[model samples]
Target: MRNLTVIIPTYNQKDLLERAINSLISKCNDEINIYVLVNNTESNYIVRNKNYANLHVEYLNTNCGFCKAVNYGLRLIKKSRFIFLLNDDTEVINQIDIDNIIHELIEKGNIFSISLKMLKGNYPNLLDDAGDMYTILGWQFKRGNGLPKELYDRPCEIISACGGAAIYNKKILDEIGYFDEDFFAYLEDVDLGLRALMRGYKNLYYPYISVLHVGSATTGGKYNDITIRLTARNSIYVIYKNLPLPLLIINFPFILLGYLIKFIFFAKKGKGKIYISGVLEGLKNLPKFKEKRRENMRKKKISNIKLEWILIKATFEYFHQYIKRAFYTLRGAKK
Candidate 1:
């Protein structure tokens, strides 16, 4: 197998970050290089303490968020052809066949990214993310999240690979460009994956490679003010930056409806004000996103019809799933 670089972006979670690095070191051979991008911190504990043959660490004085940190790491790795992005909160529980996966990637010419089977660390039986899926309403979801592990038994093609524990071909990033720094964090993976799709590249969900992720470890556990605000804000940017003008116009109603429903749902959780603030921020940055949209569209190799086929046709199905999950959560709270 060709030499691979694993980039782990971490914030203030030094203990968890150390554990994550140790897990990789245990499983990875000398051929694998681990790059830990310590974002916005002065902590040199990991750099000083962990002494491995292939480990390297870099620190950024300013907090640049997940997107920028990963991009910075990509720029730093000059030797490796394959790059794997892993979350600092994740742990590698099983043995990985890196050579076999690399061979599979070579065999599949169109594949630019591979999504690994990520199981929730807390609940070993449940999945954290199988891959990522995009809807016509401009929503991106974690495929098979919180579901039984046995459900996803086969390898298949997916719309996008989750940035938490996915591998990417360097050539694809060179062509389609890196993660949008403006995204900061949320939905940025979807934006990159969508861009890859537009440029006639494919993403695959490889069930063979696996990891354990403690979801949302850095951002205060999924639905906090920061998470909601950034997610709401970046969601708009993704829609504007990726879709063609015609498709954007066609999907406007559905997008509006989706936001409306999201507002109501978050309101139930007392996050309506934060969510609305994010929407306003997103709307204010429309001009910036429009420029990005124009830049991305110029590189399109796939037609709107072909892209439409890949997108989820019925947007309501996702909403239904959300409502069902919410209902169960509410019921459990009452119980």
Candidate 2:
């Protein structure tokens, strides 16, 4: 039984994929296994040149979405205590000790999932997010979004994280279920993290290990109409499925206000009313999400009040004001 199984799910980002593979091949400390699932539709791309002569690399027969591709690899690996669902566009920069992460897991004995410190490529002061967080409303966000790199060293509990890079306890995943395949791309991590919290598990952000993220490499910075629609629809799914009564009451106005502001911003940016389109798609699927949530609540004895703080952090949209102010401070403090 090895300590970890590092899985990277990729589609069409060959250049970044090569760089990420080299970074991991260089820094891993123990005899851990590496699994890379190529989810590309076309027959070939010549993705691996690493000379990983000692690692495991597999390709799915068909191109499944992000969640399903990783799960395919999981079905192959027999035994791993911890599973690292890493992104193909991120690079591990430090010689992270797997023993330390495992030891911390034993010591805490409670945390179910986490993400390493994520610094944006070539922008040391800017953070991709130490981990993911949100409010009760349908606004999923990153922790320390524009905060200085120094603040990332602090370890804390977070609502959820960008699935691009995060660690999960295999046992916990089995308990709660795999990433909701319906969320083909965005907000899947948030949904999984929320499910665990609702069942009394904690998702944390750890800084002992660090990595550089080539953010949004696959979809580029912003997407075409389809990606935008999917993202909008999924964001609403997260809020609808995880929101509890108290936090919903407190944050409903904020959710509406946030989307209205986003609508104007997107319109000015020439993004064709995607905010409205996304909400409508979400509403059309609301009955499905509601049923899942009700079934989940029934199976787990924990009440929403016990998980209120997690809900608040999961839907935090108020942090944008802080982010704008902090970007200036970060620039001033940068070396």
Please tell me which predicted candidate would have the highest TM-score against the true structure: 1
lDDT of 2: 0.75
Listed in order, each prediction's TM-score against the native is: 0.92, 0.89
> Please, what are the lDDT tens digits per residue for candidate 1 over residues 1-335?
24578999999888888888888777764457888899877655555334676778888878899999999999988877889899999988877767777887744588899999999998877778888888887778887676668877788778789999999998778777899999899899999998998888889888876788998898988899999999999998888888898888887887888899899999999999999999999989989777678878998999998787677542454566567557756876899
Q: Residue 68 in candidate 1 has what lDDT?
A: 95
Error of 1 at 287 (Å): 1.1
For every candidate structure, what is the RMSD over all alpha carbons to the true structure, in angstroms?
A: 2.7, 2.8
Q: Which residue runs of candidate 2 sit more than 4 Å off their true CA positions?
A: 41-43, 46-54, 223-226, 245-250, 313-335
Worst 10 residues of 1 by lDDT: 312-321
* Model 1, residue pairs in steric clash: none
Supply every candidate's count of residue pairs whose N, Cα or C atoms clash at under 3 angstroms. 0, 7
* Deviation from native of the Cα of residue 33 in model 1, angstroms: 0.9
Q: Could you tell me how far off, in angstroms, the CA of residue 231 lies in candidate 1 after the best superposition?
A: 0.3
